[model samples]
Target: MRAIIIDDEPHCISSLKYDINLFCPEVEVIDACHNGHEGISSIKKNDPDLVFLDIEMPAMNGLQMLDQLGGNIPFQLVFTTAYDKFAAQAFRLSAVDYLLKPIDTHDLMDAVSRVKLRLNRDVSRQFDNLKYNFGRPFAEQRVAFPHRDGYDFVNVKDIAYCRADGAYTTVTMADGKSTLLSKSLGEVTEMLPVKLFERIHHSTLVNIQFITQFIKRDGGYVVMGDGVKLAVSRSKKDRILSLLGLERW
Candidate 1:
């Protein structure tokens, strides 16, 4: 598979390259970039099958750069970082794989094998979904809920709605508690299973199961089981109504 390496640290990139060549012999390293800007350009230019990305870099961090790219990320990503503790939950939520720095040859091989399997099987489906929603709108793309102290879970189901709090999306759960997830609402909505969740408004995703009542207002609103009122955008009202089997009303 063709691949690109993106990291500010030259040694980190070099080590990864060596490991890929030595252990992951099937992976071809087409290019490498020093920062997020260069990484974006390289990805757009090469359109490689995979990307080895670093989380912290100059100008734009990995997550921000991914956001800027909108969707259709062009390749599968295996994030390489020294700090894995903070991002483990986020990675799990997105269902993306990652490798910790001071790289392990065995773990690298495992990650590469997983990538190859995905490419051979499910990559097309994932790519199509991401491409279809590239930059047209903003929706919750992922979630990170506190797990055990410092860890978190994506919890796509428990999320009833998400509100934009500047750069963060406040994910409101069915239980009435809220947590700040690091992705935008638009991105989250696109990444999530569309049949299961609908973006009723710019800031909300009302879980069809948790919706207790639908109130007709300026546009529409849903009263979730937990009694939280969430607004439904005019454009999405029909879809939400249809999903809830309330279209006849």
Candidate 2:
């Protein structure tokens, strides 16, 4: 795939280009731009299949640049940012690819693979979702789950609990339906806001809003809104009690 690398830092552009050349032989770097201005012209001239865009830049940030480009962007985009959890959450909910600072080799390759698979698809919706989310409150923001073909966007409030199954997580909605996410439980935990989700057990994360009752008898478990009961770890019991504002029963 023909690609463009856009960043404000020269060394970043150089390092990313070198990495791409070394690891992703299939992704040719057609153009490397210093800032948003150069990036605009480079994009027009190169018309790359994929664009690696840095989010924060002086004069014109990536989001501002993208805003000026209008809504009908024709190429697949991968955002590069300095490890910010909130920003990454927005990207995930939008199904937009993002790489944190000091990008990992495995991560870059995975992003490339996902981009290749999603090529030729219209990404206007995803972009719009991402932009909209940046301005919205965390509680109101929706979560997007990646599937085999695309993503399933669901309201964050819809999730009742997340159950870990080895490397994957089973996200159960309040309605009792569950979707197995490719991400591990720890990874999944990062995607969720800690204000709403509590790690009740080593293998389970429960949405605080879904708790119906906390049974203290016989090892301790919380009954969810969906009538599902999940165990609470002894270490986390006090925290859960504090979160629920409950007196020990």
TM-score of candidate 2 against the unseen true structure: 0.84
* Candidate 1 error regions (>4 Å): 84-86, 120-249
Model 1 over residues 1-249: C-alpha lDDT tens digits? 999999999999899999889898899999999999998888888989998888778789776777777755646778776764533434544456667778889989999988886673333233332323333222334433322233344446667766776666777777788777666777655545554577777767656778888999756788888887888877887887788887644
Q: What lDDT score belongs to each candidate, Candidate 1 first?
A: 0.70, 0.88
TM-scores of all predicted structures = 0.51, 0.84
Candidate 2: residue 35 lDDT (0-100): 89
What tens-digit string does per-residue lDDT give for candidate 2 at 1-249? Answer: 999999998898988999999999999999988889998888888888999999899999988888878876899999999957766788887878999989888899999999998899878778877887875777788877777776787888789999999999999998889999998999888888788899999999999999999999878999999888899989989899989999755
Pairs that clash in candidate 2: none
Clashing pairs in 1: 138-186, 139-185, 139-186, 139-187, 140-185, 140-186, 140-188, 140-189, 141-187, 141-188
Q: Which stretches of candidate 2 lie over 4 Å from their true place?
A: 164-170, 174-187, 247-249
Give residue 56's error in model 1 in angstroms.
Answer: 1.1
